[model samples]
Target: MAVTRQLTGIQVRGLLGRFDHEIIFPESDEFIILHGPNGVGKTMLLELIQSLSGTLRIPSIHRTPFSEVRLTYSDGTQFEVSKALQETLPLGEELEKQIQRLIFRLRLPDGQEISSTAGFDSEELASPRFRDWASRVLDLEPVGPDIWLTTGGYTISSLELLHKYSDRLPTRALRTGGGKVDARILAFLGENEVHLIETQRLLTLEDPDSSEFRRGSTRTPAVSKVESFARDLTRRLADALAENSRTSQELDRTYPRRVLQAHTEYPSEEKIRERYSEQNELRKSLSAISLLDENVGRIEIPKKMEPWQRNVLWTYLEDTEKKLSTFSEILAKVSLLQEIVNTRFLYKRLEIDRRRGLRLVSEEGTELGLSMLSSGEQHELVLLYDLLFNVQPGALVLIDEPEISLHVSWQKRFIEDLQRISRLVKFRSVVATHSPQIAGKWINRMVSLGPGTTD
Candidate 1:
């Protein structure tokens, strides 16, 4: 079953330098724009919110000690996660190594809390309070020092005191208003629903023949960008052609050789009689292959093309053409190629040649490489393609600095274009930008982040 989950809001405390205590209001609009001046930690706050979903793992050095994040879902359920750094005693001058630990607590509507802590001492699992808490919340009765807790379909064995729930509870009790508790927990952990677009979103398309063709600081080859949509279209076309070839092979194998000989020239009565017998034998073989009676002769081995067969073949060809046309239509709809072609005379059409990569044909019959496009145009194309083809529906998309490389006019229409694209893709987007032109008239949907801001 597909569940519709939306992030209502998030509260962070003592996480980063700027965000001592911050409350982000993301529920105001499906599309959110976070705009602020430089050094305000706008990008850091975005990263921290993304990390809280549990999809991204922060490095130990980047991880802050004594940080708490509370995320509220649309269903009123809350996920509260906190991390702390613990240090042991040192012998002399050298300090002891610090261990970072995490804790998870699920808050229900009835005021009940399901809590578990990781990185605790192994001996602590033997404590009576820990066992009682496990039995009540995790539904586990610990018999020994080592125990496992089964929650939300996954087994939690990190704590030695945790044990799997022995009794099977009612299905209704296990599920919250939205869905299963496990699914909610997984959703909070950024399972398949979070998409993070970093500030450095530009893709470098390096020309193999000339190093001067490379643009940007990155010198990555062209294969990375080409693999995105071009490869998928190629694979689909290959599969379709393979299917057609298989069908042709099947027809050839089932065709009778005697019928071919009879049709090669005008047949005499004797020759016709002999071919008729061969045809009967051929029918028998085909009947056996098709699991039908010999007399049925359902598999027609035509000596010559009939009018009805010609019509059928033409219809099949038309259907194949329609399949290819449909693919082109989908590509045109999802990408900005058609819009670019319609407005700008830069290209007349966009096509993919098997020998060459993506090609743009101009009005003057000139084939232009993708690398020939300006940086702004390339950024626009790549961003649209990634949004349309890469991200899934209902995903929380976090884009950093969308106005980079875009013209002032394009920046003004950025939110509008995003809104139109969202109609087809159906994703919740939170874009961080410094340009007021990008925000435009959507100021009501905008959230401002300031330095040393607290909730």
Candidate 2:
């Protein structure tokens, strides 16, 4: 059974230019689309949601001194996260007056609230009375005017200490929300439930079953973009290949055992030799084909030749190319047979080779590498693959631009294809596109963002 989780609404103030929008998602399976021009806060809105979900760090691009975000989940759970900069006190009366402070607050579910404040004044941060207060509230003993807890503890200046505390204060508050509620919120905000597919083509050529993918290396940036999906697919494919290899070995062993039994029952040395010779010949033919197939992409015709000779060369090259194309198409069809069935695209094959990486083959057996694909085809393949394989059911997928490289015809079918894929995967999506063709007939779900608009 698929888990159902939804973001009902969000309210923001002083964050990325005062965005205040209530996104009431459809109770049905329909997804939302944020249509707007460039420079609007569409991507910022997605980042804010991602931050609220605790999956990403708060963007440093926010120039505002204070910001607040409130989120309402489908389960009636609510969260409000706020951050305020430390103010400066008047120079003359600073010692006599209360110091200015930076404040961080979080209002969790069940009406419970947690708040933390850090003073800006150096004297206040060093004072024994203030140290006692910190000890009581934050459980840290002051070792020196600039250090806290034990001698081996963090040895930072007063200002840096305050800043560090303020930065992590929200996470601390989350910890205090009662174990069950805290766990639930963390799970809800986890990467598995919230996916953000940024607009960048990051790919690297390496073995899929290599240690890099298995141990989750950061050297591959594209892997991080689709981390969970890549990890899961890598494991599944590696296991499947290993199992198939084992089955083949088992069959080979069984064949010898069967032959030995047959020989004991009715032995014939000439018959055995003839059978072995035939099998050897078959294996040699297969080996030759495999070697030729591996080098198909490198095959090139000579430039300097007579017309008739060139024609002959062209015929040979064309036949070889046809065989290679058919081989690629067969591989693709076998790999993505199920996906092809669901989407019904003219693309018959989608292959993620251990060595070659991703490739697409048309129904007519035209094979193309990822780089060789047209812009529209690349966009369609990347988006569809991410939606179908990466995103989990009931999760919110934030797509930046679905129509960037799509043709008008493809743009028109974009929403329809997305809707079909979403239904099959049981996930929800919020797409940000500028093309009306991409928005299609889902205008009811569209929220347009314009210049100087709060919502």
lDDT of each: 0.54, 0.52
Off-target runs (Cα >4 Å) in candidate 2 are 1-3, 54-66, 85-110, 114-188, 202-235, 241-357, 361-367, 451-455
Off by more than 4 A, model 1? 20-28, 54-66, 88-99, 108-112, 117-184, 187-192, 204-329, 332-337, 340-349, 352-357, 451-455
Candidate 2: 10-residue stretch with minimal lDDT? 209-218
| Residue lDDT tens for model 1, 221-309 | 54545344555545544554455456555555644442333232343434434544655564453232232245742234356655445
The best candidate by TM-score is: 1
RMSD value for candidate 1? 17.2
C-alpha lDDT (0 to 100) for residue 415 of candidate 1: 80
